[model samples]
Every structure is written in structure tokens, then in C-alpha cells.
Target: MKNIAILTLGLRHNYGGILQAAALYNFLKREGYNPVLLRKYPVQKGWKAIIIKALEILPFQNLKGFRNSYIKYINNIQFFDEYMPNQTKIMTYKSQIEEFLNKYEIDAIVVGSDQVWRYTYINDTEYDTYFLNFKLNREIKKISYAASFGIDTWEAPSENLNIKKYLSDFNAVSVRESSGQEICKKDFGKYDVELVLDPTLLIDQSFYLDMIKNKSPKNYDCITYILDENTEKKELVKKINVECQHKSVFNLLTKSSKLSVQDWVASFKSTDFIITDSFHGMVFSIIFNKDFLVIINKDRGADRFYSLCKILGLESRLVTPDSVAIDRMAPIDYSKVNEILDQLRVKSKQFLINSILE
Candidate 1:
């Protein structure tokens, strides 16, 4: 079996990041390839990091800061220790990453299934790394599977130049959205870029269902997985809860209480309906055949929602809080949705197979 190293966002407090990384790993493994997540620690050496470190050591760290950090640490522990036990140890520097790749005898490096190419998450100097900049043997394949830009537009002229140069090295390039395909063509002049499904969507619903099969179900009429705590969105959920007075509403976005990945899946599975501003939240809802509404999150890139809904022919599902009455909308007829997904799944699977094998 060929060994593949996947470079993605670090295992952080975010549920989507952790789950997508695991999805790619699991998908490759099921295809008879050995896939391991390359754990890259964030570079924390700016004034912000300095100030945080000083606060911690001076015994005067504010209670709010301490509490937030503790919660993040606990989330990381649960994700790394329990969910992703086979992930590589922390690789802090570029040299460490190169050494680990060589030591593992990795045949290919896949940067993907998340915002690995998102400029905001990375420093300017490290742009090439996401493009697989490091030296490797000529026979080693360099590929990107469902890599996302997280936004519709490209960076500055100089940045685009650098991106174009680095991206030219890839053996295969696949993006997560249609907007990403346009960007690749316009910015990098890479017209052959394949628009692939997100790693989570690449895997079947059965993969997630198996994990929560042994767990007990929770009682909830609605699950609101709002990532952006917008006042209007929260109020909408509240209004819906009051209207459905007979059933209980569960808010899965509690700040202090972070649920395990399995618990997150179970929450969605057990709920009668879902209302969310998260991309992944909307995705799982559709996959599970649950009726849901997507509140466009402009700040966090609404292109993802637009692209996905357009492809799946669920554009009506994406709406503002005030535009539609949650209760009045008819139940989603998933026949069309499922048919579209079936075709997409076949194309996406073939893309992955061709990217890796040929």
C-alpha cells in the first residue's frame, strides 16, 4: 500500500476541522491506502503570543483568558487522544515536517479537504508549504484533494504570482467549490482544476452512522448548530422554539460546553430539524435527510453555501432569518437531492482514484 501524508488545519477546538481531517484519512484507508495526518502546529511568535505568554508566567493572567485557553486545550485533547489516535506527533518547524515525511517513507503529500490554502490561516512566508513546496523525489506524487480557498477572491498580485508558481508543481489539483474552480482558472490559469466534493461529503453517511449506533438518543425537536452567534439568528431559533411549544429545542453552540465528535454527530442524528450558519452543519443535515435551513454567513465565506446549494438544487433552503417562516416551509423532498448526491459521489470517487493512482 502506498503511504499518503495529508496536510490540513491543526486539530483545534473547531468540530469541522477535526472531522474533515478524519474523513479524508478514513476515505483513503478504505481505498486500501495508508493515510496519516501530518500534524502542523501553528507558529505562535508574534506580539500576541508574547503577550499571552507573559500573562501566563506573571501569575496575573486574566480569568477569562485562562478559562478560554483551558477549554481549547481540553477540546484538542479529546480530538487528538480519542478520535485521532493514529495521527503523527506535533511538527512545529519546517525541518521537522520534512524529516517526518522522509522517516515515514511517504509516497505522496495531499494538502486538502479544508481551507489548507486559506491565506488568513497562514503567514505569507509559508504559502508555498501548502502548495507542497518542500523537496521530494521525482517519483513522489504531489496532489491536492478538495483544497479550499475559503473565499471567492484571490490575494494581491504578488501573492497570486507566488501561488501560481507553487501550484504549478502539483501532479493533480482539485478544489472544494465552483468558485474555487473559477479562481484557479482566472488567477493561476489552471483550467483543468477539478471541483470535488468536501471530504465529509466524499464519505458515505454509513461511515458516520456506524459510530453513533451504540449511543443512546437524545430528546430534541430541533438542533441549532450556529457557528456565528449573530443576534438575529439566535432570536430566530428562539422564535421557532416558542412556536414549537410541545417540543424541546437544543442549542449545540454553547460556548463553554464542547461536545465530543461522536456526540456532535449524535446531536444531529437525533434532532427532528436543524438550523445552522455552519457549512458542515448544513451538510450533515442534508446527508442525514433532515430538513434544515442555512443562514448565509457572509463574513465566514458564503460562497460555500451558494456553490453547494446550487449544485444540489437546494437554493431555496438558503435564506435569511426574516425572509422565511421556519414552520411554514414544507418538508424537503429529498428524492431529487439524493439523486444529485449519488451522481456527485460517483464523480468525486473517480476523481480521487485518478488523482492518486494515475
Candidate 2:
């Protein structure tokens, strides 16, 4: 068995980060590799640093602060592993990283499942720069597996120079979206880039179902929305839910609503339709074969949904705030969606598995 240090996003409460890490971890274990998960830290001390310690409890603004701090700290970031709430419980973290590097006497380290490298998520930490220059040390092989810059745009020239310095460390790299690939090419001037699916998509529906032990949702027709972006506004969601045909509508913004990602996914599978502004909101709907309308989110890069939709050939279903008629999204071609997923599944497996084997 090879000792693999797999770094992934650790914020488990976040759907995309958690599920992507789960997919990669499960796959790596199946491949007979002992993978050690790492959580990236931006600030090392102070009560203010406590923000990341209780990220879920902190307000959205503070979460943004941690994200920004992380970007500044780690440059060649990959995957971040989510630790349990208590820090002492994960005392072996550094030791595990060192052990994995020395023990199975393995081949390489893998980073990513999502936007682990995007500077917006990194804060003020020198680790951000040195981690990318890790290659120059030449002690171990480094690879980025389906890592995302996460955003659709490029940084200014000065920042690009900082980014370019660290990107030189990767032995191979792949990104989750075309937009991110474009940024890598433009900013880092790296031509060797492959497109890989988000790790959530890397695994099949059965993988998720297996996690829940034969669970199913309440059969009622429901409309589930996780309001991460524009759709969070009360008026917009109320307007859509008021007009939709579904009997029950649920929003994550409510205090009483404590649904986990799988809970949300299960609900998506049973729902007749979905209207969402979140990226994973669209992902689960498509995975479960639910008819859904993606709201254009100007804040979180609206192009994200459209880019995924375009890749799947489902662009006609996109909805805007003024569009006002989600009822029109009915009767999506489930067969067409399956066909696209089938192709993507093959591509995803080839990209991830072959890259590892190579």
C-alpha cells in the first residue's frame, strides 16, 4: 500500500467540500492507498483565529474572512480534511502527515477536490506561498487532482506573479471547470491541464445512497432550496415557492431547518422540481434526475451554473430573477440528462483513475 497525503477542504458543513472529500477519500482507500487528510490553516494563533475553530457557528461574514485568510496562506493548496469539533481529538494530524510520508514509503501527495488553491479563500499566511514552491525541495512528488481556482476570473498582475511562483510545484494538475482551467492557463501559463468532474460527480448515485443505509425521503412533492447566493433573498424564494406546484417547500435559512447534505440530497431525489441558486443545489437535482431551475447568482459567479449546464447541454433550463416562471421548467428530458452523465462518468473515471495509475 502507498502512503498518500490527501489534502481536501475540511469544512464538512459545506456540501460541495464535504462530498468531494468523501468521494476522493473513498476512492483512494479502495485503491489500496493510506491517505492522510490535512486541513489548511491561515492564522495560527489568537482568539480571532478561533473563528475557523467554530466556523459553522460563526456568521457568514466571518466565514468569508476565514476563506480569504486561507487563500493568503496556502498557494499550492489541494484538499482540506474536516476535523472533529475538538482540536485535541485530532492531535495526530501532523504526525499522521509525517508518518504517511515515511511509512508505506509511497509515491506522491494529492491535493484537492475543489477550489483549494484559489487565493480568495486564502488569507495572510506564508504557507500559501511556500507550499507551492514545495516542488523545488524535491523530496516527494506532488499532484493536484481536480483542484479548482474556484472563481471564473483572474487576479491582478501582482497577485498573478505570486500565484505563478507556487504553481511551478505541481507534477500534474487538473481543474473541475473550464473557467478555472482558463484562469490556470492565463495566470500560471500552464498548458498541461485536464478537465475533471467535481468529486461528488466522480462517484455514482449509489455511493451516496450507501452512506444513508436505504433511507428515502417523505413522498410529498417538495421544493428544496439552499440559499447560498441570490436565491437567499426572502422575496425571491417566496415568489418562486408561491408559484411552484410542489406541496411543501423548505429553505435552509430557517432556524428550525437543520438538514444535512444527504438529507438535502434525499429531499432532492423525491422532489418534483427545484429552484436554486447554489451550485450543489443544481448538482444534486441533476444527479437525482429532478427537474430544476437554476437562478442566476451574480454574487457567486452566475456563470458556474450555466457552465455546468452548458457542458451537460441543459442551458435552456436556466432562469433569471425577472424570468418569474419556474413552472415552465417541467418535462425536462431525463433521457438526455442520463446520456450526458454517462459520458461524464466515463470521462471522470478515466481522468481520475488514469492520472493516479500513471
Candidate 3:
């Protein structure tokens, strides 16, 4: 079996990021390959290095903070053990990452399924790493699977000429959004890139249902998975509550959220309705066949939401928070949605198989 190393976003608090990376790892393992999710952080240098060290030892990083951080870190490791068992040691510095990759002997590297290529998220300091443009001790196949540029536009810190030089290393390329295909050709001068499903959607919903099967998720008629909560969102939830009356609106990013990753999946399964601004939230809503209303959020990469929904024929589900209030309890016909999803899943998996085997 090929020893594949995944180069997506690091294991972190974001539910979607963790799930997508785990999904990719599971998918590869099921395909009879050894897949590992590399744990990494952006390299720090100069004043940034000084500040990071300072923050590590200062009043904010007191015994209390140390205890909390330790707990969170251990919990994260345990979660990965259950889902993605083959993981590298946490590497916060460039040297650590280089040493591990060299020693581990990865046969191929997959760079994506998240906003890994988003310039604002990664910035200039880590462009080469995210692009899989690093120099390794040995040659290995480099490819991007459903990698996203976050948005449709070109916003990388480097010029297209320089980016093309780095991107040329990839043996094959696949993007999560349709917009990324155009950007691949126009900005990076790479054509024939395949557009594929997000890693989360590549797997079956039964797998996710199994995640919550033991959790005994609480019953709720409605829930809001708002990524960016605001007055408008609060008001919208209030309106939805009038119809649902079991409003359990919570931002998983919030410090107060004790909802585990598996619990979040369960929430999607238990709820009858979903109102969300997040791209993955909508993805899960569709995956679980729940009625949903999407908040138009260009700031959060609406292109991802648009591309997936457009192909699945769920355009009517999208609504701006400012739109005239409509009936939130209307049923969504997911018959065609499931059909389109099944068809896409086949092609998406085939793309990965060809990308790997070719």
C-alpha cells in the first residue's frame, strides 16, 4: 500500500477542518492505502518568534492556561486516534516538519480539501508549504485533492509567475469549488484540473450517523450553526424559534461551546431544520437530508456554497439575512439532491483514484 501524507489544514478547533481531514484519511485507508494526516503550524520567525515565545510564558499562559491547553491538546489527539490513527508528531517549526517528512518516507502528498490555499488564511510565510512546493530528500508524487483557493479570485501574495513555478510540481490537481478550476488555469497556468466534492461529502452519511449513534443526541426541532453571529443572525434565529420553538443556536467556535466534534454531527442528524452561514453546515444539512436555509455570506467563501448548491439544485435554499422573512418550515425536496450527490461521489472518487494510480 502507498504511504500517503495529507497536507491540509492542521488539526484544530474548526469542526469542518477536522472532519474533512479525517474524512480524507478514512477514505484513503478504506481504499487500501496508508494515509497519514500531518500535524503542522506556520513557521514563526524574528519578532514573531519572540512574541510567540513571550506569549507562551507570560501571564496569559499561566498554570490555568497550561492546564486548559494540555487538556484540549490531549482531547484532540484522542479524537484523531479514533478517526485518523496514523498521524505525525505536532510540528510547529519548519525544521520539525522537514525532519518528520523525510524520516517518515511519504510516497505521495495530497494538499487539500479546505481553504489551505486561501492567501489570507495562510499568508506569505507559508505559501510554499501549503502549495506542496517544498524540497524533500526524495521525490514523491505531489497532488491537490479538492484544494480550495477559499474564493474565486486570485489573492495569493506571490505573482502568478512565481506561483506557477511552485504549482508545477503537482502531478495532478483537483479543486473543491468550480471557481478554483478557472483560477488554476488563469492564475497558475494549470489546466485540466478536476472539480471534485469536498472531502466530507466524498464519504457516506452512514459513516457520520455512526459517529453520533452512541452519543444519544438531544432532540431539537431546529438549530442554527452560524459561524459569524451578529444582530441579524440573532434576530433571524429569534424568528426561526417562533416556528421551531426548540432553537439551539450556538457557534461551535465559541469558548462556551462544549459540543464535541461527534456531538456536532449528531446535532445535524437530530435536528429537523438548519439555518446556517457556514459552508460545511450547509453541506451537512444536505448530507443528512434536513431542511436548511443558507445565509448569503460572500465573506465566508460563498462560492463554495454556491458551487455545491448550484450543482445539487438547492439554489432556492439560499437567502440573505436581510431578505424578507419567509416560511422557515417549508419542506425541501432532497430527492434530486441525493441523486446528484451520488453521481458526484462516483466521479469524485474516480478522480482521486486516477490521480493516485496514474
Candidate 4:
């Protein structure tokens, strides 16, 4: 079997990040490739590393800085322990990445399925490692599958040339959003980019169905999976629950619920309705054929939601906080959505196969 190394945002405490990484890994495994997640640790050294270690050791429960850092660490540990055990190996430096590439004899490196390409996400660094900045042999394939820019547009005047140069080296490139395709063409002058489904969507619903099979159901009428905790969004969910009698709303991520990734999938599968601003939340709701209302999250890449909804013919389901009159809205016609997904699934699978096999 050919060895494949997936470079993604696996260390994030977010459900979408973890699940998408799993989805791509699982998909590659099913395709008969030996896939491993490249766990790239931050290149903290000397005083910086020592400071972090000190903070970790210090029991400053009263200090918000120490408390928040501790919580983040705990959450990351929990995610890796429960969901991604034995799937990852560490690469702490650029030399380590190069060493790993040679050590594993990896056939290809797939960068992907998230906002890994976004400058802000990479601490505003130019020529992020996600763009495959490392030196490598010319023959080894570099593919970008469902990689997203996370915004409709970007203004990286200084990095434009570098972006184009790095992206030019890819054997194949596919983006998660239509806007991404546009950006590649307009910004980088790369017209050959293919717009493909997120890795989360590329997998069959049955894949997720199996993961959630034996889990107990959540006792709620609606599940709200909003990433942003704005009062307007919160109040809209509350209004919907109150107006739609017998429908109790449960907020998921905002409350920092201790539900594992699998547990979250099960809860989403079992919920009667979904109220979400999260892209993956909207995705799962559609995949499971549940009734859902998408709140527009302008700050968090709302373009992705719009593009996907438009493709699936469910743009009507996307609404602003001001448009939360649930009684007036019609149920989603998922028959049409399923048909679109069926067609896109074939196309996305072909893209993956061609990117890997060709």
C-alpha cells in the first residue's frame, strides 16, 4: 500500500477540525492507502518553551490567563486521547517534517479540508507550511483537497507571488468553496482549480451513521451548534424554541459541553431540528436529512454556507438573526438536496482518486 501523509488542523479543539481530519483519514484508509496524520507541533523553543512549561506547572487557578491555557490544554488532550489515539505522529520542526517525508517514504502529502490556507489561522505568517513550503523531491506528489481560504476575498499583497509559486507546485488542487476557486483564478491567476466538497461531505452518511449507531439519543427538540456567542444569535434560538412549542433548544459548543466528537455526531443525528451558524453543523443537518435553520455567521466564513446551500438548493434555509420567524418557514426539501449530493459525491471521489492515483 502507498503511504499517504495528511497535513490538516488536527490539534484544534473544534469538532469540525477533528471530524474532518478523521473523515479524510478514514476515506484514504478505505481507498487502500496507509494514511497517517502529521502532527506538527508549534516550533516553540528556549525561553518561549520554558515559559509555556512554567505556566503549565503553575497552579494559578485565580488567574484567567493560566486557567484558559490549562482548559485549552485539557481539551486538546481529551480530543486526542478519546478520538485520535494512535493515528498521529509528531513533527516539531521543518527538519522533522523533511525527515518524516523521507523516513515514511510517503507517496504524497495532502493539505486540507479546513482553513489551513487562511493567513489569520497561521498567525498571519507568510508562506505557511500548509502551502507545502518545505523542500521536497520533485517527483513526490503534493495535493490540496478541499482546502479553504476561509473568506470570500483576501488582500495579501506581499504573499501573492509566494502563494502562486507554492500552489504551482501541486500535482492537483481542489478547494472547498466556489469563492476559493475564484480567489485562485483572480488572485493567483490559477484557473485550473476545481471546486470540491469538504472531506466531511465526501464520505457517505453511512460512515457517520456507523460511528453514531449505538449511542443514546439527546433529549432535546432542537440542537444549536453556534460557534460564535453573539446575543442576537442566542436570542434567535431562544425565540424559535419558545414559539415552536414542545421544542427545547440545547446549545452545544457555546456551553463547552464535554461531548466527544462521536457523541456530538450522535446528538446531531438524533435531534429533531438544528439551529446552527457552524458550517459543519449545517452540513450534518443536511446529511442526516434533518430540519435546520442556518444563522448567517459573517465573521466565520459565511460564504461557505451560502455556496454549499446554493449548490444543494437549500439557500432558503439560511437566514439572518432578524429573519427568525420559524412559523413562516417551510421544511427543507431534502429529496433535491440528496440528488445534488449524490452527483457531487461521485465528482469529489473522482477528484480524490485522480489526485492520488494519477
Candidate number of the best TM-score: 1
Per-candidate local distance difference test: 0.79, 0.63, 0.80, 0.79
* Candidate 3 segments whose C-alpha is farther than 4 A from its true place: 45-74, 243-255
Which clashing pairs does model 4 show? none
Q: Write the per-residue lDDT of candidate 2 for residues 1-358, one digit (tens) a residue.
A: 7656666544434656666767777776766766665554344478765756566344454455454333322321222223211111222233444544554455677778666765556443543432334413236667777776656876445667666666676667777778878888887787788877777777788876766555576764556465554433456556666676456775544544445555656777777777777777788888888777777765666656766788888887677777755464457787987888788878877766665667
Instruction: Sum up the clashes in candidate 2.
Output: 24
**TM-score ranking, high to low:** 1, 4, 3, 2
Report residue 157 deviation for candidate 2 (angstroms).
3.5
- Cα lDDT tens digits, model 3, 147-219, are 9987989785466887788788788889999999999888888897999999999999878977778888767
Native-to-model Cα distance after best TM-score fit, residue 292 in candidate 4, in Å: 1.0
Per-residue lDDT of 41 in model 2: 38
Weakest ten-residue segment in model 4 by summed lDDT:
60-69
What candidate 4 gets wrong by more than 4 Å, as runs, is 43-88, 124-126, 254-256, 324-327
What tens-digit string does per-residue lDDT give for candidate 4 at 54-129?
A: 7766764524354444565566675565444435566566667777776667899999988887776654223368
State the lDDT at 184 in candidate 4: 94
Q: Among these predicted structures, which one has the highest lDDT?
A: 3
lDDT of 2: 0.63
Clashes of each: 0, 24, 0, 0
lDDT, candidate 1, 59-176, per-residue tens: 4344546545445556568656554556788876666777777667788889987777777766534666777887643456889999988789865556787788778878899999
lDDT of 1: 0.79
